[model samples]
Target: MAIDPKYLMESYANPIDYWELFSKSGLSKFPPCVVSVAITGGNQGKESNPNLPETLDEQVQQTYDAYKEGASLVHIHCRCPHDPSTVTDDPEVYRELNRRIRKKCPDIIINNTVIGGKWSRNGVMCPPMNVSIPARPEVGSVDITNYTWSMMRKGRPEYGRPQDTLEEMQYTINKQELEHTLSEMKKYGVKPEFELFDIGDLQYLRDLIQEGKTDPNVPNWVQMVFTPALTYQTPDMLLAAIRHMPKNTVLGIVATGGCQYPFLALALILGCNVRVGMEDGYYVEKGVLAESNAQLVAKIVRIAKELGRPIATPAQAREILGLGAPRMEF
Candidate 1:
């Protein structure tokens, strides 16, 4: 049998044309929209806000409530009950929490955090192991710095007050730890949302992809965080970081304090996603407290709708994140 000339020549044509054709044919619409709820972060204890849940039970309840409100995905950071201030890297902690969350709300997608804890020596860091692949190009690099106020005590205790010292401390991730954490993440089958604090982190991800640890077809969501104390996370910063992102990846913005609205709006406008919760910002607006994760999700839903963008359902979001459809058993 003779092969068709058009089909043979098509292989040499631009990939962009193929993508345009696929998009025009409506194959793109099948992937539902995504709404990720950042449930409980590692930082911000009960002292910061009594509403923040510390234990697994409380975290599960909070996640269930957010799902009810409209969150299809939940970003989780497991905490140690013995020390509310610390973040635990133990897989059991994450598995237990995942189990509870699955039992309560099986349909919601669960995203686990590889970035954990505030180390006096290392500050804030990435997963212990570096996991990246050639096709994906963004999974194995460590571009973020871990810094905390606790480091200030090293020098002049008097000059290094609680707020001042915590704001200035910083640390970097080593290769061994990065590999270990990525291995654990894969073992759990929990999707990871790479948290990038600066443009350097983006470069690290790119290197990881080149090294062959990340999967290109999978939706690797990268979050750009702007904290209140240190540097400002501007719109330009987001654009710069994502300028070189691979086709299968998605970008999200997380503002630590009052900049959530600005960055959230920017993310949506830039054709990216947005994450909001007590973990990112406590205030719904200036001087107003967000009562729950649902309240924050509602606000994002309203914003997306007003901008003519639709909010994604849990099932749809699962497909986008490359997760299996909600299993009642899980």
Candidate 2:
């Protein structure tokens, strides 16, 4: 369906739809928007995007650049020191990564993923949901539920080894593991960024809170992270999820493919923060791939500014997330 000249001319009437949404939603008065750059995903490496960092030095340097480009916090997923593409669940790996990143850019708030990695082993795809970091990250992710993706890793070199013709993959967020992971985070003073892919994940979290396992007094980083298997991907779906979410929390939106860019503005309009990078999306434009994580971050900063929302500093982000001071020096 080609958008002809006539259609284009008609579009000018409401050319900037985001403005209309913001004005109608009364989201003009927005909190400082925090931009979190996921430097690397536990499942992907240089194969997906050569610019994706594979070494500790690369990750730290890339993250430092992203910090300079207005990124307040960084979401980290470590790659193997030996292979640079493999994901490891070892606590030492997490500790070393945290230490190196801290030594380089001490001011950027650091977040660690609970997921170590997922790969096919012995003809079975193991979900790396069972993990605990000894490094004691300032914040960690807590994912809920799992979905089956038919096209998970078929001929998708980006998903895994291109040579392996993989089948259906079940990326489950093991409840038992999640409970343990959350307990560890609490033990180490790490706040969890509860990541919900479906609406049901909310009730699961509430149950945990009621059990006195979690503290509602602290502002939870409630993340509405989307997957390809998600039944709902529309803005209205997000709105509905937001309604069900606990009021005492900070909202963030993360989407894959090319949807990350649109969500950046939509989140701001709804008074939500944003997660952007090669992990969430690889493209800065329709065909242009981002050269670095900072490039993707800089793009969102511009969009937030255009909407009259200022970017939050590291200190502001810490306040928004109810986090302590920066753990290291820059």
Candidate 3:
């Protein structure tokens, strides 16, 4: 059988497409890696890791430290001012935080979470989902699939419950929420950092793109979230996930808890970007809690340097991700 000339040429469309070339040419040809740090997440707070930043001042300072250490992007989850344990829905909180982060790290890409804490009982999505875009993030994380999740954790004092008591949340992110999220992101020019937990999420996002629901010109920024509950983090699963992504996708990898380091290293070696920080995991190593988000950023920087992959600066990251100037200035 004769091979087609069209199949013989190299066409770099997505991160995974580099696999064959990388095998033959080696790491010298790899592009600069974008390191995004989730300084704080909506879930977990000082209780989980005493050093985790839950206040405005702490978050800003931690983010600045990470930025200085080579993190080109930061994922933000602003905590309620009054109750520092729970995540806030108030756009003011988000806006204020973004403004401060901008002042400290002027060029770093600002990303806000779309999913916020629900009333511990009902599963309806609230607050930040509607307000994240209004707060004007350059990127908004949207979980593209609909799923139900239930988890129990130590109750926070702010929840009016005993610290030892286990509080549970059984929530669902459905189609209605997904549609609302996509619409808001489109309106604000916020790039959708689609969080893919499973292969179905990838398929759903591809359908959205095919149906013209997503902006074709904008790069599909995907973060493959690996966790015990969502998608099992394994080398084969990671490879399969990347292989199924649509062309023109910019891939980022993140894993919860213990899987963090190995997957992050794998992401770099595979020519994909990476996301780190306290949001994904609070530890710098096994049983060793990271004192600050910057510590994790510094560790990843060291890994990238060791692998001969240069870390992208904010300007370089913006260009690599095809993002324009800040959508809305504070």
Candidate 4:
């Protein structure tokens, strides 16, 4: 069957209504796929994967390597220099990190985390909100939903730490934090990446758009992070997420742990973008540890290539996400 060029372009523009046309179209009709790599997560560090970058220098190098391997967008979490175990919310730390990163990967989209880092401000644990200042990252993640993150590592000898362990932490971003985060993003011209965990979060975003709290003009970057703790990694869940997404959404899928590879591949087939890195999963494959973030990125790049999906460069990603030119400079 021959596909019309105008119709295919329209399908890319009107993604919500054109899902059938885009997904059913041949390889020639596939839109450029943006590959985002979350270099390091706030929860686990060298303990989970020895290669996980913790210091400022390590992160910059890892990011540059990933960018070379076809990842156009980089999601970052700055670890407190003083306490490497905990994530930092210090604006100065984020500023310095973003500066160093820009020096290395100039055009790659720098996305700082609002919910990844857990630090104490008055002896009370809190997520970072000052990530946009000074750094003014091109993108910053805003977690819309709250849930308990429960995980257990049992007899995983491949990892550096193989001890059987269980962790259950209540993750949240309160109303005040949300207001401040949104205000800061608007102030700095940073694109908001909505971190969603379930179907309800999509509704919450919809309500925000209707309330005029969120800018409806800008395309919504909805990143659905699928984990068994909050939402299962399954086709039904992914499809439901796509079905509930609001109009003008650039959907990105992330599955925690071992499901990352398969989940992202499925996302590619459905004409959605994908995220990969140690933050999401440490292993490149089952029982095979990933040496660096670039390795994970290369794996996905190969998958997208095999599926006939062209990888989006940083410049292309900016256009796809409806972002302006590089805002922050060193």
Candidate 5:
């Protein structure tokens, strides 16, 4: 049969019919992209924003309000009730906060933090503590056969440490710490949102999965947090990091300070989810501090809508993110 020029022109001019047909036949439903509101980070002080929730009661109330406003997920970092400057690694605190939020908004996904504040050389907030141990016999054996192995398995096996002489190894939270945190979250049916500050963090997550530390059915959501002072927090850099992310992993962008909104905008445009709040950036605009976490989320929602993107609701987000039953009844 001879190809018709007129037919070719028609196909080119109106591809919508073909696209819709293809979409219906092959594409799974595109879950509405979720917008997570990070109510409070562990680092920021009350001086930064009086509206920032510091105490457990304040954190719970703020998280509940955000969920009511339209946040499907609340990214949380528990601060010491007595000291905002200190980051608590206590699973008890996380459990309490998680319980409170679940009671308030049953369907809202609670994302707990694994990476605490950056510890200083004197064990303060600057250089994070280093935790390294020899890979288990199985991990080492698997490295020999696994095609995906990338770390130096033979060298002085350092797990989570900055490669610097001046870097002092502070208190290292081991597998016990991880188990404790995971156990608490499991109690409330809350999902952990891992924060990968560097490639090492990504490797650690893979290890967790391999060691059966994390459940496969549980949706593995990760945030690629970029620190401009420590690492390049640019669009290209963020994209490069995403390229290496594991499959079935949902990613959110979290760039500190000036690069925060810009990276978030990039994430939204790229059809990925995002996290924004006082934890990532204090300012809603240049030189203007955000009054609340809701304000930040509202701003992102506005931008997403303007770009013709729909914000994911709690149920829709759960489906998209592959979460199990909601922790509490809605």
Candidate 6:
């Protein structure tokens, strides 16, 4: 008997099938985009947003809620009770946070952030200093360019300072620094989530991949961080990133302010994954505060659905990212 087109079309579930359909239709390639919720804003806490997760229980609950709302991955930034504004290098906090979150949502991909900052009383926030991966989570971020990471400059008051007016640390991701983070991550088999701040950062990542520093066995996850200070947020800048984007690697974005809503829409059209939630921006709209991370994730899930793109399960996300079998479920 001849095959039924309806049956064939209805049975398609994976990203490749959708990709083929989009290509055949001559539309912009749209694939299943993985949703990653950055559980907490870098320094935001209850004091500022009141909705920010600071306590261990709150963090775990928020993460679980986000996962249930179709977020397959979570960017885990261990919280410290002392001050919700600065990151804690203490290994205990990282270990506890990772353990609890993993237990809470086994299938949800965990990506730990390695960042530190010195809060200046005078309002000139120092670049996040002493950045380290205290927790050996599934993945950690690796900055690959020279730039400043100021939430203020990006229209997000992470440091709660005036944008571009206060001085911040100039984060230079030199070879030595990259190697150090790599060494630390290797100790725990943690994959590096290389961040692209500009087009050059992409080229640098290419060099590392060629040098065997970034082994191909592990799925490379590159996050494009758009910022005014870095000058890599425009369509032309995105073109530059895709121009040098590495082969067979995951491409995602962390657009700050309310930019994620629009930028994610564009990135999805181009078949790129996404990162959202309070870490990037707390606004569900211009003046409103996000009640929870799940709210942000659901927004993206809805958009992808309307665009005729299926959502990937936790296991599929793991497989797409080349994460190991069994333990890392879909």
The estimated TM-scores of all candidates read: 0.74, 0.84, 0.89, 0.87, 0.68, 0.81
Off by over 4 Å in 5: 1-30, 84-95, 116-121, 124-190, 207-213
Clashes (backbone N, CA, C under 3 Å), per candidate, total 31, 0, 0, 0, 4, 7
Off by over 4 Å in 2: 1-28, 116-132, 151-167
**Best-to-worst ranking by TM-score:** 3, 4, 2, 6, 1, 5
Ranking by lDDT: 4, 3, 2, 6, 1, 5
- Residue-level lDDT tens digits of model 5 in 1-330: 222221111221233643553356321222345888777764444556678887888888878766766678877667765555555656566667777778788778766554422333344444221110110000000000111111111111132232322333232345566666555545544455666666556677777777876667644667666775445777777666665665546666677777677677776655467777777777889988877778888888777776666788988776666665665432
Q: In model 6, state the lDDT of residue 138.
A: 73
Name the best candidate (by lDDT): 4
Give the higher-TM-score candidate: 1 or 6: 6
Q: List clashing residue pairs in candidate 4.
A: none
> Which predicted model would earn the best TM-score?
3
Per-residue alpha-carbon lDDT of candidate 2 for residues 153-215, written as tens digits (9 for 90 to 100): 324354446664445555655667667777777787788888787888778877877777677
The local lDDT score (0 to 100) that residue 78 gets in candidate 4 is: 89
Question: Residue 245 error for model 4, in Å?
Answer: 0.6
Q: List the residue pairs that clash in candidate 2.
A: none
Name the runs in model 4 displaced over 4 angstroms: 1-25, 116-134, 152-165
lDDT of 6 by residue, 1-330 (tens): 222222121222344665575667532234456788998855555544778787778889999999999998888665556655655656677677778888888878788776322244235454342343545677777666766444332223554543434335455456776787687778777778887777777778778889888766655788888866565566667656655676656778778764657877776666678888887877787898889999988888888787766677888777667776434321
Worst 10 residues of 3 by lDDT: 1-10
Compared with the true structure, what per-residue lDDT tens digits does model 1 show for residues 150-199?
A: 32221222222244233344444555556555665566454556677666
Error of 1 at 206 (Å): 1.2
- lDDT value for model 3: 0.77
Query: What is the Cα-based lDDT of residue 26 in candidate 1?
Result: 33
Model 3: residues with Cα > 4 Å off, grouped in runs:
1-20, 23-25, 116-128, 150-152, 165-168
Residue 237's lDDT within candidate 6 is 72
